[model samples]
Target: MNRYDNERLSAIAVLESLRAGVPTRASTKALPDLRPNLLEIFKEDLKIFAGGQNLPGKFVWGKYGQGKTHVLASIEHLALDMGFAVSRVSLSREVSCHNLFHFYSKVAVPLRTPNSTVFGLQRLINQKTEYELLNSPIQNEGRYVHPLPALIFEDYFRTEGEEQDTLYGYLMGNPPSDFKSLHKKARGEKPILKLERKFKPSEHATAF
Candidate 1:
């Protein structure tokens, strides 16, 4: 009777066809139309950024069910052929115990570090904020410190099920460190975790 019900009916029709092994009408994807041109643009833009020409990132965004995910999958497929760093996240598992920490090894009975009790996480990777690096003994004890790289966040607007809102909050609220810079990326009035980087990159990068 209403739009929501109609949407449900349409989805059911799609499912019914799949279940019955009936073929639905097929159409060409935008990926075949635009991937090469987009990849070339990204490569040129990345070169400019790497060379310190003050460029922006290359991200793609599209409306829901518009095959954006499929396009991203195609990109990942290309990445594999080209040997690029790639990963896909399942927002459905944001709070799973397995994601928290899997490798377990108890640090003998005497966990001697004094500040260890203060921090919640057991495993500590040294992180270097600009201030810490300048002031601390890090120069004396040389070590690279960081979080995951080029964090890829997909499905920002997924409506998966009961856990959907929770997972969305996790994504919008506490983004991984690499994207801490984009932390200010928010929805309406809610303020999300953001990075200290200047607005230069976010300003120029075009998504969609």
Candidate 2:
């Protein structure tokens, strides 16, 4: 659906509205308003990711509260709606080895893929999660038996931070299984994009 000017937004729009948990009582199905510039950026993204197209390494950065998280959430919902694997997180807490390593194990959404690999997603901008869930085992004739590819997407970024290079490095290469294990055996890791240091100091500490 042409979000710029349409009778109604497409399933993507509906998914985004839902992810945001916003109420859109105006219609039986809620959707996001394209708002011109927003629609243009989305269209550009589509063009870049078209079938057989080669997309260069790119980072999406915007001022705080400028809908970056919303856009990623919408994309994730869109992926899920398309029968793709998806896992997600919100880096609103402290970042520990446990926080970095717990990229998988979300299981699955109630209505979709019981055996599909978890979707790795996070809401912390410019942070890094040490390990990625990679792929997960799927069911064969009787039970989940094979591994399926898991797609990773990011919500926000800190642009240039201490973990910035390390975070991007983790996304491009293979990650060890014990990558900063909570137990810290020094042997475990997974590869994927993530948020870092976002969950430090604590939110209530600044109220003084």
- TM-score each candidate: 0.27, 0.29
What value of lDDT does candidate 1 attain over all alpha carbons? 0.36
Candidate 2 lDDT by residue in tens digits, 105-138: 2222122332334323222222343232222121
lDDT per residue for candidate 1 within 1-208, as digits (tens), equals 4556765676667566545644222111211445577666655655565465776445687788665655655554444344333344433444332423210111112222323433222132222222343454333322312111111122222223433333333332323442332333322224553434432323312110
Lowest lDDT block of 10, candidate 1: 102-111
State the lDDT at 19 in candidate 2.
66
Q: Write out the backbone clash pairs for model 1.
A: 180-195, 183-194
Q: Residue 207 in candidate 1 has what lDDT?
A: 12
